[model samples]
Target: MTITVILGAQWGDEGKGKLVDGQCQEAQLCARAAGGNNAGHLVRVNGVSYSFHLLPSGLINPTCLNFIGSGVVFHVPSFFSELAELEAKGLSAVHDRILVSDRVNVLLDLHVAVDGLEERELGDAAIGTTRRGIGPCYQTSRARTGIKMTDVFYPDLFEQKVRRLADGYQKRFGELFEYDIEAELARFNEYRETLPKYVVDGVSFMRSAQESNANIVIEGANALMLDADYGSYPFVTSSSTTLAGIIGGLTLNPKNITETVGVVKAYTTRVGAGAFKTEDTEEIGTKLQEIGREWGTSTRRRRRCGWLDLVVVKYSNSINYYTSLNLTKLDVLDTFETIKIAIAYTIGGEELDSYPADLNILNQAEVVYHEMPGWQKPTTNARTYDDLPKEARDYVEYIEKFVGVKIKYIGTGPDRDAMIQRP
Candidate 1:
């Protein structure tokens, strides 16, 4: 594939890392479009487990060059921390292989401090952010007061900008915002010598990739339902986490995208606070969580579990336009006696036109579900489509039919290569 975007079809945590890692073997360029270290993609390679936060999952493929695009809100300290971890895990020659966008916004530790304070101010109405400075950093970015990637190299400009940002936050939060700007600048002074080596102009970088006809893989962080514009308002992540993000984040042309592959779990899950119409707070929900080990990779918080909601996925597809689907974590549902898929939503005995944006309306919406027979047999051993039991095949076929997209790849296990690809 020339250009493929692997996106989470629901509310993130869809095992995108393993999928991107597998695809990276054939890819020359792997780029992260949106979000920040708040998004995590875990990939296990040859018994070594890697958790990618700020970095691209493609680093595991030594031959695949990586790009952290302009649309990202990057924190330098987190970047080095993650990079050092990956290096210790035996991924060598990493420094020469990855590039950062010069136009990318910098996420400060001060911003991270502000993030928690803002959430505290909201009290019970908080958006349940990861407190990694994602929201605050993006806020500074849009307001045009944030530090750019290239600013770190200029001492005066970087210091002036950081002080201005710190002053603004200090005024907003008073003594509650206790950040050492001098220390932050000093840390940046340490980063300046090293970071410039990896910086690149995003437009020119993608232009070169296009000229080479590189097999580019765009790894989407977060998910469509958590998008800034389309997702649940105020509760959503900072950047656009859908197909629209891929273009803005990468500074790439839409025509360059050859395939938009949506990664969906056999069941659905979401993190933080939101009105989940199909949210199962009962035994089935607990079972899905415990069996699936549904904890977030970034925040380490237990994800809110529920049955697969096609209403959510279909709404996501309408925005991202997935060419095919990757039904992941099928084996997680192996022990369940029956599996359910939410087909539609209704409240007051009337069907709604689409996924209503109003959280109040969503809270009152009744999820209309369709149940299916579970394949008690484990799918972990299946190497081919026929290897799966008929029940499992039926489950896959039904999802493919319902979603209006072929399930081109089905993940049977947690390993990076434990996937069946349909040609």
Candidate 2:
């Protein structure tokens, strides 16, 4: 069987959830590799919209095995809360389909407290995190003082670790909150009781899947441009959001990867703080925002919208080596008389060869735009590639040619049937 990785080519919210959900139809197993509840994935199936923070998007597909990989920093409360929400939505088989990697780092209340306090301390220079304890949890993991999914299964060891972390937080943040060690231990025990059925030796599980020729689809959180090591740093997330992360998280051979589909929106949008080189704060920008409903699924913050930044996507292609592209939100641009695309970045009047990683440089870089005729006509109902307006077809062709990657799937709307798949 084949394994494919569906990743965001732009900053997070490149409509990865819909693409991942679509890909689930052919796969036996689907897994999330990085990040945590900090990332939001919205998927609409059969007219009912579902939002995911901790669960894999593949949970919508009953036959698919959904997993949270070792690279994730899972918050126990959010995990259970999300499951409850899914149950209420009638997907009652969630428990049977989902498996949690025992090696995942756990995010505790103390970590969430520290996250908010730290962001507040940063004040005007804050990175605009989700305050979901992602940064603090990863920090503790790197510091070798973090808790794992399996840690809660052992009572004495779990209590010792919680006390140590609580003491550490108090010493570091000077009363971020009243973290009662005993109460926290009681909560941990509750989580431990329910976690046994879900927790698994993930590496072994994936290896076995591979051996059994199960088609696996890895659902990546965030995007390549938000990766801590390669993205605009300090303002970036605390995890790897690239191909390397998936391989490391799942303990899979790179050769097991048959395809890598980079999901991108028709225009650019990013949440949180970072340099947005092509951001437009004008009328067109606001129109796109209104039409596209450009708001963070988790934070509900308005996303900064602008022209499609090919320079950034080209740079992302280099990083992820995408085998194909899934162009999403094409309908968002239907009302524009003319569509603008940032073909290159000019810094100090000199064209840069690649997208800059340094926040300072990126903040100053000017977008070199290329204007194209807009389709103007709505494409949301188009089920085939030939059904798109000629102008829309041309726009897609231009992007495909410039990025040097074939556009395999085109997203016309937010629903499950809103995509056009090309041969």
Candidate 3:
């Protein structure tokens, strides 16, 4: 295949890093198309764990080239910090192996300060952002006033842009936040000195890669429910998290996209504030959280856990047109004697077949669940589809039938090898 996409079908933490890492060996290139350091992906190989916010997980494969597409908001501090951490883990050629899009917007110190102030302004109604300045940077980029990666290479332009943005922020926030322009300029200049080797025209590179017929994998950040257009309002992340985001970010031909793998947890978990229609809030939620380690990779905040919602998955399938589904954390559901899956939403007096975009309707909607029996046995070592216990197999089949997509990959554990692949 020339291009295969691995996307988070549920909320952000769907173990996409491991899924993308597993296929990196087959890909000639792996590119991250959207989001920023606000999203985190964890990949484990040979007993060592690798976590990435800006860099592609394919960095684990020394031979596979990686790119950060223009759709991403580039955070310089996080970028260099993550690269150094990966180098310490023995991936020493990272500086040469990766390419960053020159068109990507730069995340500045002022943006982070503004983000903190904005969240504080929200008070109890905060969106629970990671405070990495992703949203503010994106807002600036859309306004056509933000500094780009290319601009930072020129000292004069970089300084002017920094001062301009800092003055605007200082005027808006008053004493609530400080904008240190000189310090920021110094740090950015140092970054510009080191970033030259990694910079490239991402759109042109992707086009050339296609012409060369090189196999590529697009790794998506965040997930469908967090998408700006389709997700719950105000609580949603700032960027596109669906397939359209991939195409827009990379400037890729949609016809070149072969397989779109939608990764979802066996149940459901979401970080930050939003309307969780199926949230457990009780013992089942606690057990699932404890077993699944439902915590944010970037924020480390405990995610709100709930039962699998076919209503949500079915909605995601319609948007992405996934070729297959990668069901992760199934083993987390192994302890439950009885597990629930949300089949539809009960709104007021009537049941709805489709997910509603309105925050008010969704928040008021009740989950109509279908109960299933758990396998209660470990599946972490299962190597084949048939190796799974009968109850476990049934749960997978139930999700498949309901979502109208094949469950081709079953993640029984966190390790790269702890999965059953169905043909």
Clashes of each: 0, 0, 0
Give one digit per residue, the lDDT tens place, for model 3 in 311-352.
Answer: 888998889999999999888887788988999898776998
lDDT of each: 0.90, 0.90, 0.88
My TM-score estimates for the predictions, one after another, are 0.98, 0.98, 0.98
Model 3's alpha-carbon lDDT is 0.88
Candidate 3 displacement at residue 92 in angstroms = 3.9
Encode model 2's per-residue lDDT on 1-423: one tens digit a residue.
Answer: 898999999888999999888889888999999999988999998878899988999998888889899999999899989988988898859889999898999998878888998898999999989999999999999999999988888899888898888887788778556666677778887877788999999888888888987888999999988899888777789999999988998887898899999999999999888788788899978998999999998889999998899998999999999999999999988889999999998888999999876667787888889999998898986899999999999999999999999999999998999999999
lDDT of 3 at 237: 89
TM-score of 1: 0.98
For candidate 1, the C-alpha RMSD (Å) to the true structure equals 1.0
Q: Looking at candidate 1, what is the lDDT of residue 188?
A: 86
For residues 205-304, write the lDDT of model 1, one tens digit per residue: 9888977868999999999989999997878999999898888889777887899999998888999997777788989999999998999899899999
